[model samples]
Target: MHLLKIHGSGDARLDDYQRPEAGPNDVIVKMKNCGICGSDLTYIKIGGIPTPGTITALGHEGSGEIMEVGSAVDGINVGDRVIVNPMQTPSNIGSGGPEGAFTEELLVREARLGMSILPIPAGIPYEIAAMCEPLAVAMHGVNRAELKAGDKAVVFGCGPIGLGMVLWLVDRGIDVVALDLAAERRERALALGAQAALDPTQIDLRAELAKLHGEVPSYGRVGVGTDAFIDAAGAPNILSEVVAIAKYHSRMVITAAHMKPIEFPAGRMLTSEMTITTAMGYPTEMPDVIAAMPRLQDKIASMISHRLPLSQVLDGLKIAATPESCKVMINIDEE
Candidate 1:
């Protein structure tokens, strides 16, 4: 088998490895697709997984077909199309773990029916099923916002995860206005059923949200009535901007990973009683995303902007790091 591994800083290579066999409670899967995440590039930039001189395989978001099932594993059979929950594995399958999904075949240790592996819901393609991980992350962020049906939301980015947030919100009948610096991303958000998409550089976001969602006045300050603000852009100014214009009791959820520390305007946020929270990985949202995939297939499928084979995964990483790409996937099995 071949796997993509990071040796040191800026050094990523596809190397040969021994094929893994299923253990008593394990399963071996023929990887079909793996999505390149922004963190993958970060892993390369910082020299390996955690330190300057370490080694680890390089993928997490993946979907595949079970090739060999352990005798002890029940209800999961060979040839089952499934998406992996990396976090549930004995060693988190990727992100510095002993195992990674960017390979010809993956060994899922102690595989459980719904915890370690989930069957891809029918009607969702492999490419889209590969997105279940990231979409789950996005859904976790949306869940943090605690949005209601009639509430309005403004997503501050339109990349893969951001667009996923838009799709999830729209599917639940929430009116959403997505903002991005790239026109193409804005268009993608619109195509995914966002009520409106705007380029933040060209318009006053506060005024624009007020127009779309209405305006509220409190403590002699006017704020947009948008109920939830999700910061998926990770821009330094986004936190302050949301604090400045958020309506009373509005919620702000930070889904993007920021490299540097951001200054929070605690004094300003107090005036509106605005709540700010952060979301990390998906905890219990993966199953929900998989369940929703069938109904939201078209919109979710549109999030993938590029696909490359496992042999060209290094090139795929470069494309994925650029703004021009939404979700760059490695078609490992050409399925």
Candidate 2:
């Protein structure tokens, strides 16, 4: 089978690998579409994710049809269209060390055993299904923030992950100010239903947030002030600002999954009585992540800004990294 293999740092190519035999709990799926993730950049630039041994395979975002199921598999059909829960594969090491979803086929457990959530339904397109994993990341960030209705959230970074975080919050009827330096992503966030898209470079969040919600009284928890602040850009020096922008009891959820050194202002952290929470990749979001598919059917498909065939995977990967496109997917059917 054809798959992406990283021979070394700054090296990745389409290579052939022996297909895995179906395990008792495993299911094999023919790939339809999979997304090029932001984190994949790290893998391509640096041979592997931080804290890792060496593995040949990579790619977790996948969606397609169930080709074959192990003898133990049941309650799923051979032709069911599906979206793979990226949580399917785990990082034996930390920070995406073992996450490799880009492939022509998928082997996963039938149940919640891993992050693989299947059966996306024929009505749903693989493009959107491929995003289930990231949306779940956004959802997890929202949950970690411990939100209540009418809460104000400032989502930093409007990339797919960041934009998805804003969408989930908006879907829950929360007020969100999406912060991003990219113009296209900001536009997509608004189109997908973010309350407001603010360019961090143009407008001052402190001024705007205060203007919108009265004086930035103190950040709140559950409700009041800026309840939740999620940073998806993984920028290095904004934790303190996030804390300062947030009300006193606010919770800051870091969802970038970025593996970089960041400065945390302990003095402010201690003074603000704030909470910092880190969301690892979909630790427990599989079931709901699957269930969320149909609910977000319309919004999901519309969220796609570009689609290309597998032959253009290289270009697609490049575009997905650029600010010009919100989400770029590859169709594996091209021969």
Candidate 3:
């Protein structure tokens, strides 16, 4: 079998690897499609995600069919289609480590198979099912924010995750103000049902929020009061900027893992009594996300800009980094 291996910075190659036999309580899946996450590019260029220099096998967000099941495995058969959750341990298949879904086949432990190896809903396409991982992440962020009906929010990015945020928010009856630096992304956000999509670089963010939601008078200062401020963009100055326009007693969920230390003035947060929290990895949110796949199928489909086979994995990475693309998927099943 051929697998994608990341050796060093800006270095990746397809290497021949031996197939593995499922243990007594394991499941082996034939790879179908895996999306190239933003972090995947980061791992290829730099090194390490959870730990430094840990990228061995690449590609995590994927879906496949069960080609084999161990003797001890029950309730799962050889023909079951499954979506592999990469957040599991790397020692097993679909693990969110160096050993991921970039290969032709994967070995996953049955003990960790509950939410980790979700059976793809019948009739859902492999490419759509492959998106469950990222969509799950987006759903988890919304779950963390605890948004209420009719509440308004400003999403700080319009990438895949940010766009996913919009879809979830809109489906829940929340009005969203999608903010991004790129015009194309802003347009995409608007098309995704964002009440307003503004490029922060060109507009006054605070003033625009004021227009969407009425002004809030706090301690002789006036600003817009929004229900939540979700930052999906890992930009350097976004934290401080969001703090400036945040509503009093509002919730600010940091979905993006900012690589650098960002300065946040405690004075600003204290005055507003705002709750600033962060969300990591989706837990127990895959089911709801999968159910909504049919409703969001079209929008989710638009997020994918390019779909290439494993042989062109490196090229897919390059397109993902460009401004022209939103999401890139690698077809591992294509031989």
Tally clashes: model 1.
1
Scored against the true structure, residue 202 in model 1 reaches a CA lDDT of: 96
Which candidate tops lDDT? 1
Best by TM-score: 1
The digit string of per-residue lDDT tens for model 2 on 53-157 reads 344456667777888877776676688777666544443211254224566676664433234545675566777778776777777887888887788788888
Q: Which of candidates 2 and 3 is the stronger one according to TM-score?
A: 3
Candidate achieving higher lDDT, 2 or 3: 3
User: Model 3, residue 61: displacement in angstroms?
Assistant: 0.6
Local error of candidate 1 at residue 194 (angstroms): 1.3
lDDT of 1 by residue, 1-335 (tens): 78988888889898998866678999998999999988888888888866767888888999999999889999999899999999899878878777899998999999998998999987678889999999998999999999999899999999888999999999889999999988889999999999999989999888888889999997889899999999999999999999999999999999988989999889998779999999999999998998888888878778989989988898998898888789999999763
| lDDT of every predicted structure (CA atoms) | 0.90, 0.70, 0.81
Range of the 10 consecutive residues with the lowest summed lDDT in candidate 3: 89-98
Best-to-worst TM-score order: 1, 3, 2
- Preferred candidate (TM-score higher): 1 or 2: 1
